[model samples]
Target: MTETSTVLRTGRKFDQVLKGAREVFMADGFEGASVDDIAKAANVSKATLYSYFPDKRLLFREVVQTECGRMSEQILSMVDETQPAREVLTVAAQQLAAFLISRFAQQIFRICVAERDRFPELGRAFYEAGPRNGCKQLMDYLEKAIAKGELQIDDVELAAEQFSELCKAKLWMEVAFGVRTSVEQAEIDVVAHSAVDMFMARYGV
Candidate 1:
């Protein structure tokens, strides 16, 4: 089920609930987080939490969607769509690399994978809200670049996906696999710029 279809209601405290849910989910994960803890963290009564989100799954999904929206907006604000593919893509790749190595993103990804067998829909929802959404944003920007004769992409969707993977390269895998505790800015720049260079080599006109 989609994130929007799962929302039961909204009110003044909607954002407050979401903030609390996000914190708890990130800390305790989907299965470990409890309604009581979420309610306490939100400083809302159980009844109030239930009124806003009837199910824990709905709350978790909402948090995921909200976080994804924030990430997309952050990247968009950092990127200049009017710029050439090289410039715009360097910024985009840097942001993507930063996010891929982020603790929050890693935890959300792990949660989805860890619970996928029991709650397959959560995995789908996360994919649609997170990775797929990011690709769509990149696709839009790539289309604009194509129209401007800056890039010559045969398949915008595939190119977007490839660029994202290129950003991950060796850094994200190292972080995700627990081989690295943190990534330096230099490392991010190296990976991000290399990704941009590789992408432009393939797609730039």
Candidate 2:
């Protein structure tokens, strides 16, 4: 295979492994899941699974990171310089909420909460790879907006964090507590608009 093709194949295999790990972890929890089950779910041999991931814990960590990374990328891509600040912020928040409400996200949250005691490292990894990275990305975007005179903020980092918290507050709580059944797109839109309004009132130019 050409180098590009090889890279693509490797990425596809990794994605397959991540998807399998998500199913197994969600169904069996961290403690109950096995490497064999993940391999079966991915339709790959144990050797292939091991080649991609050294161990089950590592596989789970990768799964969390991949999900969080995907969400972060989506949110980042939604920012548009040509758009109004409020509109940009609203879209970003809505995208973030949609990501958090996804089945993969909910499953990752459950895994972290349930396995925290047993796998403290996994919990730390999740927080660092997911929330911390997400907050950093938001802060970077907000800082750029402020520098461009689109926003007026004394503390970009704090504002970014608050923006995320506001948008995610209810959905996150519901997901964490297993009370959220389905969040409609309309509800997401409302929350996103409200968050944008509140944020703009505080920092908009």
Candidate 3:
């Protein structure tokens, strides 16, 4: 059987189907979303949909993974290994924090939490696609910085997680709960710089 990821790159029709499915999933969420709705939205027969994605759960997982993968690519692309530690990290933190608090990100997170018990792999895939990828990208930057004698971190992985969490701090929870609908660039800048400051305080040489 062809996997969603494999078919994802095969042709235009596959792209259309997944894009349509993504819209339906985002609008209705996991449990509320129906295969019929997805097929209609995709303008494909149910058999066609199922051929690409074995089930609704698999479709949802692929949709979430696709979004996460795109975001991770953009976020990781923004990190420049050759830049100074503070400069590189400050930019990285700002972009990461912005993405984390965006409405779309929050919705994806909520969906994953709602479906996690029924479908643990979705949650694991979400974690792997976003946070784990973030941690690895940050760790790579930190490792490069350490090699250049720019940082003094003993545990790169923990530092990567801490720095990522630090960037989110108070705002992620607020955005996720609808306590606020959006964040200002100024506030993002403040949080990013603050996170970088704290991170460097511990690890900067």
For TM-score, the strongest prediction is 1
Query: lDDT per residue, candidate 3, 1-205, as tens digits?
Result: 4234443346557777788888887889888888899889999988888677776767766776788788877866877777899999998899889989976677778888998888777778778878898799889888989999999999999999999999889899888878988779999999999999999899999
The predicted structure with the larger TM-score, 2 or 3, is 3
Q: Compute each candidate's TM-score over C-alphas.
A: 0.94, 0.86, 0.91
Q: Candidate 3: which pairs clash? A: none
Displacement of residue 162 (Cα, Å) in model 1 is 0.2
Model 3 residue 24 lDDT score: 83
lDDT of 1 by residue, 1-205 (tens): 3335557556888888898898999899999999999998998899999888888889988888888889899999988776777999999889889998999899999999999999887888889998999999999999989888898989999999999999999998899889999889999999999999999989888
User: In model 2, which residue pairs have backbone atoms overlapping below 3 Å?
Assistant: none
- The local distance difference test score of each candidate is 0.89, 0.79, 0.83
Off by over 4 Å in 2: 1-12
Which ten residues in a row are the worst by lDDT in model 2? Answer: 1-10
Q: Supply candidate 3's per-residue lDDT for 68.
A: 75
* Residue 92 C-alpha lDDT in model 3: 88
Off by over 4 Å in 1: 1-9
Clashes of 3: 0
Give the better candidate number (1 or 3) by TM-score: 1
Score residue 102 of candidate 1 by CA lDDT.
93
